[model samples]
Target: MEHQAIDELPSGKICPQKPPKNFVLLVSVLLLLTIVQLYHPSIFRSLFLSKTIDSNPQVPSTSSSSSSDHSNVQEDDLPSITSNLKCDIFTGEWVPNPEAPYYTNTTCWAIHEHQNCMKYGRPDAEFMKWKWKPDDCELPVFNPAQFLELVRGKSMAFVGDSVGRNQMQSLICLLSRVEYPIVVSSTEDQRFIRWKYTSYKFTLAAFWTPYLIKSKQVTYTEGPTKNGLFELYLDEFDEAWTTQIDEFDYIILSAGHWFFRSMVYYENQTISGCNYCLIDNVTDIGKQYAYRKAFRTAFKAINSLENFKGITYIRTFAPSHFENGMWNEGGNCLRTKPYRSNETRLEGLDLELYKIQIEEYRKGEREGRKKGLKYRLLDTTQAMLLRPDGHPSRYGHWPNENVTLYNDCVHWCLPGPIDTWSDFLLEMLKMEGMRSAEEKKLRITNDTTLN
Candidate 1:
């Protein structure tokens, strides 16, 4: 066979034919583009044709241990489907966060008088310098502007006790960077306070129902008692909140500290028993019994509301760190730093109350799902249990003032560890938003298939 004629050089090196004009132009253009890309690395992200991943990242850890998507955990919570995926964002540690105390007491007037530790002369500021860091993944720092925009034109309520109010105030202060809320209404006792953001048209309210049920101590002829024994009706809803709850778009329910007070618990309008009353022939049920019932009633009221349509978040109990003595007997929390995981653990009354709240929340979640409602678990117990240093303790008031004063171990200081609760709140909100969109898409697909 005759070999094809080949172009060759005199030195024996293979010689190639001259390239076409179009091919030469293409090679020059490719060489120029490669140089530009090397210099301008971010240019590809802006171009749609580039293979940049425009998708969400998987959450670091979950109860289900599924590393693929958040939907696995959320689908587990949906009543429409049977699921085992569970997300546990609450299990975490306190890493050194230099950018904490995002707002000071001066910047946010929402700081209550009882929690104004910095203004009242807190000796150490290190407690406010750290943030909660989840062990499984990095939690995103709270974005107030993003939070406000997410709930624009909606209303949220904090219904339960003072700690719930503490988290609500943290949220308010966090959002103040975007827009400060104005007082729409308030009660004389500060039990019912409503604030509206003029710019965002968002309303935030707190309805005081320490018992989450109808309760009142028969006061003396003189006036109301500060530490009077309460009569908690376990089966009845506290109209203080239930009457106003239907209007809210979001409600955060929490109750823990108040149940620990000296009290009597009732059911079905009859005297069931007393917690610590030592009454004649009245059975002495434990505080946890009342705590459990209070949560159950709160959840029942939410599920019972026929016209109320909204998302409910149960922010589980935040344990108070009263050490050495009880609050009345000069108890205090004076640590300047967070505890290591090995150094402390969540147990005792705090853990018990947290578990009770969760049990009721899960039961209510199942019931609420039947009404096409949503319920979420905020689960701040484990995180806050490590921060005994976060409370105001004796720093809430002037130590030398000639007046009655008690160490505030139950409430948290402003611009302190409690602010992380708002961080958790915002993160949960993002998750809920994603889950809602997914639910809507699924519903639409189901409807189309039915047709």
Candidate 2:
């Protein structure tokens, strides 16, 4: 290679030479600045584009930015389903039935720990621990004052079996506070359990009919027939019930306890007019279907009134297990305190009764909506059965004894499981257009003339 001088030019070309060191340095600095701006956006934006931060404050900053996005994502990703009324095993201990030995004046031997509690139980300290009843088993005193405040000036009737009477007694006790010096009238056609209060005109009554409708109670003697099956005429009973039930404002109807009669009946009037044999509806239409039809008919009759503005509430089945069959094959509720009934152990027959009745009533509600009537069914069956503590069982059977009669029996003691039912009813009543204090005040104000 030939060597060239520091400053040399080709012929006819101006001197082409290297630039100054200062000029080279300036160009290098500019390239370095551009690279930094391109690689780090946050640094570049803060230095060059501060206007973006001022205009939109919602965007994330360097350190605190992640928290905002995390909260928004959580809200957007939440599940839609919600649980409202939770079914739970009862929280309290078992209380023995209060009226267990009403006529005996002593407790039954089964669960009663008291020697004096029952006249029949043998001498033992276990019997001494037994009072005539279970303490925790008694019905908790409900917020009756609040309830009476709600039901005051309203006409309500509890129509059912003796269980209904239990409810009526509790309700009467509650309302009696508002209306002292209570008055009761009883007769064949008209029966009234009333509390007269001058402060607010309110009447609460319970109409007793084990069968809400009428059916003949007949007795028979075995003669020409090898064995006699009782013949109950359900016609005259139903007619009488329909004629009388139309007067109530709000009807609380309950019936399952009465339906499980040991014997069934069929009407037979052929002995007089013409020789003909009549059979029970169960033999013809079937029990489940027949009951559904009858319920629908009764619903129609009740809903046919203009003044009957209140709701028709059906107190669903309250399960009782006196026979060990309902609890377990040989396991009966023999202990003192309440426990959970083994729902998994119930027999096919008992389960069938429960399933059919619930289905029938639920089906009735579906059919009722079409005809412009309202029927609200309250399912207390599972709720009551789960409480093994509430039953008298072996504890309060007789005052002094400890062994309960039948273990699977359904009738519960007063102020027991059924008292909560009244609470449930009050809640339902509020839902079905019962007026509150605020509404009543507004009404009174509106009714007054503005001068």
Candidate 3:
């Protein structure tokens, strides 16, 4: 063989040199990849080109920038959807709203006869025309559609006294505007009533547990004389509500007036004490003490429930606007307008009870949050205390020719101030729903990033 450099070899006569096996394999692989790139452009782009484009961002066009800026400006102009929107729905003035009294007594059959103040002959209809306006921000009008959407496929219960029933009735009437719910369950005693909106799979029920504690009426008779005694089990929960707590997605509890009534308190089946039990050496613990203990027991039972992912609300005392005398002493709420917060001092048992309820709720809220339960205070006392004109007075019942009726200053009139309670509740629900949704979104994003 003639000695020759590899590059100077003749075209026809090649030097006896073998190509490296690895180098040949590499060239073959490159050729295959080039063919694939020409045949399947998407795969090639995804494997190489797309990553580079994503890594190096391009400047946005003027139109696109302007569009984004406009969207951002629009979002800024709108009210914040966050929970930080600070507005006191409770402490505000009532402004005239021509479209007030979302539902009328005649239109809503749910209204108890006594609450039908408009049907009977309430003179001042102007009281129903006002809407609550927070000093800091405007309250969104109660939208029945929105409320129903938020509570879709959920069950809610009002577990408290007749006042709770009153609130339930107001909510039903408000929701009735969107669609009438069917009464799914009704009993003779009417202690438990359930209304269902089949379209949304929503059930609204009211569980009448007046004291929020087990109670029984005992009668003692001695030779043709009979006396009725009210006995309350301070440590026990009312079965009417306790049995159903696990089924509810939301529960609202209220108790104040019932505690005011005389009762003997028992704990663990033994007499603990008494409120106004006139026996000697059985010291009369103030009604407030009993009230506090009763609420504590109720909260304990509620918080200890298993599989309860529900939110709870403790509605503060709804004050009676009796003036010059008490309920039995011919007192009446005759004003046709709301009281200015500065014009009056909120004192007496109503204010005291309200304060106590709020304090207890705070304690419950702290404890409940630990156990995955949420508790909030529906503080309606302050705003309601201002609306003395919303009471039923003598117009709560139809006129009777032969009988005289005492004025009703305790329960509020339907199609009146009680409707505002629904407004406050709906707003709270909206804010809470927004916060919960935000939390869920954040949790999902974090989980995705981890994956």
Candidate 4:
């Protein structure tokens, strides 16, 4: 009947026909479904966006990954919102996530003794239930198998202080469900370590260059409190990481808390300045100057590394949440939950150090373009700054039995908020994959560029 309604012109050509009512209704339903897919795909199922992504989404060939990591999700999993919303994942607030904490202390053996808060009897478990939610979109849980596919045949090195190693450890624990890597290289002190995933040929390593430059720790004593001072050489690159990073495909640089320690600056083998080196006639130039110079040297070195052509990510400074007193004088982070967006702000040394890192990253990016190298930033500063409750605090030991530091407000607790940093990393990897070659070449930042 609908076809019989066609109109004919003078030349007997069928000019037009009205659309069927059912066809129009079907088109309207499809449009509504598309909107739902764009805004709220999870209404259908968990990890609902299982459609094949045009970007990198490769699963292992063997397919024996733990069922928990692959729970109702498909092998082609990607963060549903980050790739679609064009939003900044770093500028977000912590929200309740009942499905959080993919792995815990017993499940993952990579957690360090200090960060093993649960192992040492931490009181509250609520801190592990929160997840970062970007202002514009939702951030799904981290998929270990999906991340393994993203770097199946490549090498990733975490080059910085223990914080960088903390991130690497979190990553390993996240991937523990799929494969547990073997330590191919490790030092007696575990300062420098390497792990290999034989199935994927994926290599992970950590270099203990806190300064990212040539430096040494000097034993210094002052009254009852014993102190350690670092002699920083701003001009010379530390061959520990610089020489070995040539073979890596990815480099994650993180170090800012170490700069707060007593430091003596060197320029050409002689003392140039000091932050707290109480020796006579040595000018105390403060840590900011030394910190900037070291970062500049590190950035400049990345541009000059002979055969090192890989992506470098400078994770911004993660702040401390010491309340009422200094760390040495009974400081602690005792909150049971995360802070609201307005409850805290990024200020003081954290903000200053973050600015310096980003400033240097921009300069390094400009220089790297000439050499055809890629540089990116995993800006975790603002996000981590809110997670005061996610630290080990007094739980680092058995109630002050015999620990070096009684209060620890610097590093984060394992199986806690720091796991969200893995979420951020996976999102950034997906963002990189979604872009064309020219888009990746452009300089990206925490806020503006991503939006």
Candidate 5:
């Protein structure tokens, strides 16, 4: 100790380790800093390391009067329907069948209520007697031209099976009255087909998800509700369908036809593919359950993301029946005149499926609300179930006399009854108010989260 005489350490220099009275204090301070670095790295980073976090400045609050005034101004800014004429053609009653002017062989058809029931038949007629009768339950006739007014330049996608294609074609035809020319794509899937009218852009597309989940299109025929072998296509739901679709302002989906196909799958994995012809040992894979599960799956993906800000309108099931004997049995569709509006009726498993879908829809609404997602269902299934007279049966199929034209009631002719489905969609869009309600709903949802 004498020799070290405290080899006096220089100012600000570390002295040789000889337990000093304050050594424990120094160790304690070091240990506290180590704990801070381990537990609160950000604090250390901010103090020693150069780190910065960007933040937005606080926004000024608006007064209640200003908000009220803004709403009033918005109301004033809404486009007036002065130029729009109320067309009563949809409400016209069915006129008596016209005589076949020329010797021809075509059966005309029109949708009644919603079912594919027959109206009347004519042995000779160039045009089918299709009356645009409007009913109490029928949706109002919305002008497609008017709809495209605000939706111009926006992409609208209809995701589902063949029924979705029917909707696409119907929408395209409805908007044809406007000066715009429609460009339809060749392949189904996520192809681009456009309708250009002024500032509005209407893109009619088919995502071709038979089950809207993982159903495949195969060669074999399965029973009425279960058919088609599609194990190969069920792997990627988002990648196969949703990956390419984005920035959509409106989305319409329908997919009941595929449930009747041969096979259904949950993924690349097969669920079941029952034969359509034989009804024995049939699996209980109802379309309703499949649709609901898939719909919920879709909403979960949509709601989890912040960018999806659009209105999703789901068009319910479209009815199909060939059992009454396929136009030859008691089911004759050789009609030149449209059937009475109130005479339409629906039956069989189709009706049961329709009811189940409605229930699923209600469940979907609840799910969407809980997740801050906006999904609306267009209940056109009941409306379509009543329109049996609308089939092109015999009429659409038989272009020439003595030839059977409209035998199958599954598919609809162009500009036929399904056109009204598009009309319903347009009116629904309008009732939500002009300027795409989807955007408005999304805006409100986003604002709430931020505030």
Candidate 6:
């Protein structure tokens, strides 16, 4: 064909040319893609979207959907992890809780009249509202329902002095919010009291073993008759508790104040020495030595029980806030708030006794492990030391100017700082239960695989 040259169009004239088939198809495909992207953007995003690193080098780069899902998972898991983590519950500050004083002194029947600081007219109500907050993690509030479930079909005994009784009573009062336990057994002296939560088949008992060892009142009728002496049998277990030790699933033992009294020590039915007794030809051992020996003997006795499968807890010495004077010298805890860590100062004896108890607990734990028994130390010393205002002091007794009652700085007021002990105890129980459940699951999985 002969080639012909085409004429150029003018500036205002439009020139039209036939489009190629592939070009038309390409245009149609592009238009369809645009429409699809406008309607459903996710498919386009998957192909084109990219994650950018955060400006701060510390923050890691993450995909949008994946990061969102991860954040949700962490939010859900934070509480579970916090509750299960093994934290130092002893090291904490007292925070105010509006729904505190779990049970009022007037409402709780277990509270003794002497320990009812509120009923006796404590002017400051602020002390009852505070709660213990551990330094590392939040302490779970005392859950009565969970507590009952954990202790169901189990019996727990608090063995030691009145302070031990105080803790037991505090636990009873805390649990009473869920259900009122009936008095299963109580003597006229109330030395041995048992309460039963019938629905749960749980029993809580208090055994009054002031010394945690056999003690006898020795009468001295010779020459210059000194008042009777308290002869403590350091090597022997107090029959009051030993006879019933195997019956309990958990046992909490505490003793300190009773050791401060004038007492003589006996081992193997022989006189060892006397504490603060100035009898001629009798050795006058110091209080620290006697206390150490008594705790050693108590742990030894508990370790000797072959049939006891219960968990044992040695509650550390609860420091008394008898300030400016002795208990008999009109000393009292007059502060209305908890002391800061820097402000608190424990007595030499209090610290020494606490160390001694902790050492004995360690020893007991080592021995207990060998026998398949578990032992725990309830370190409540530092926590209680900060709460000088938690005591009943002059408020524990009825207001009477004529009656000269000693200020009770030794025992804590009901619904006071002592309630934190129960909180700590519940957390420990939960942790222990978690471990046990994990171990059981592991065993089941192993068995199933073998089958």
Which prediction has the highest lDDT against the true structure?
Answer: 4
lDDT of each: 0.74, 0.43, 0.72, 0.76, 0.48, 0.74
Q: Judged by TM-score, which candidate is best?
A: 4
Of candidate 4, the 10-residue stretch with the lowest lDDT total is 66-75
Q: Root-mean-square deviation of each candidate, in angstroms?
A: 11.1, 24.2, 15.8, 9.3, 21.4, 17.8
Alpha-carbon shift of residue 86 in model 1 (angstroms)? 9.3
Where model 5 places Cα greater than 4 Å from the true spot, the runs are: 1-140, 182-199, 218-228, 232-238, 264-292, 296-301, 304-306, 321-323, 326-332, 335-344, 394-406, 434-451
Name the runs in model 1 displaced over 4 angstroms.
1-87, 186-189, 219-227, 402-405, 437-451
lDDT digits (tens) for residues 311-377 of candidate 1: 9988778888888888777777777788887898878777788778777888888788778888877
Each model's backbone clash number: 0, 45, 0, 0, 45, 0
True-structure RMSD for candidate 2: 24.2
| Candidate 3 Cα RMSD (Å) | 15.8
Off-target runs (Cα >4 Å) in candidate 2 are 1-141, 174-181, 184-199, 223-240, 265-294, 304-307, 325-333, 341-347, 366-371, 393-408, 434-451
Tens digits of per-residue lDDT for model 4, 1-451: 1223224345766666767989878877887677766644333322332321222244222221111111111111121224444566677799987766778899899999999999999978999999888886666667676567668899999999988888999999988877899999957558888899988889999999989999987776642223577789999999888888999999999888888878889999888998877867788888889889998999888889889988888888899888889887887888888888898888877778888888888788778867877777788888888888999999988875877667888888899888888877776665554332324334343236679
For candidate 6, give the lDDT.
Answer: 0.74
Query: What is the TM-score ranking, best to worst?
Result: 4, 1, 6, 3, 5, 2
Candidate 3 lDDT over 129-219, as tens digits, reads 8887777656665666556766889999998888889899888887776677988885756788888999789999888888888898665
| TM of each candidate vs. truth | 0.78, 0.53, 0.76, 0.79, 0.57, 0.76
- Superior candidate under lDDT, 2 versus 5: 5
* lDDT accuracy of residue 149 in candidate 4: 67
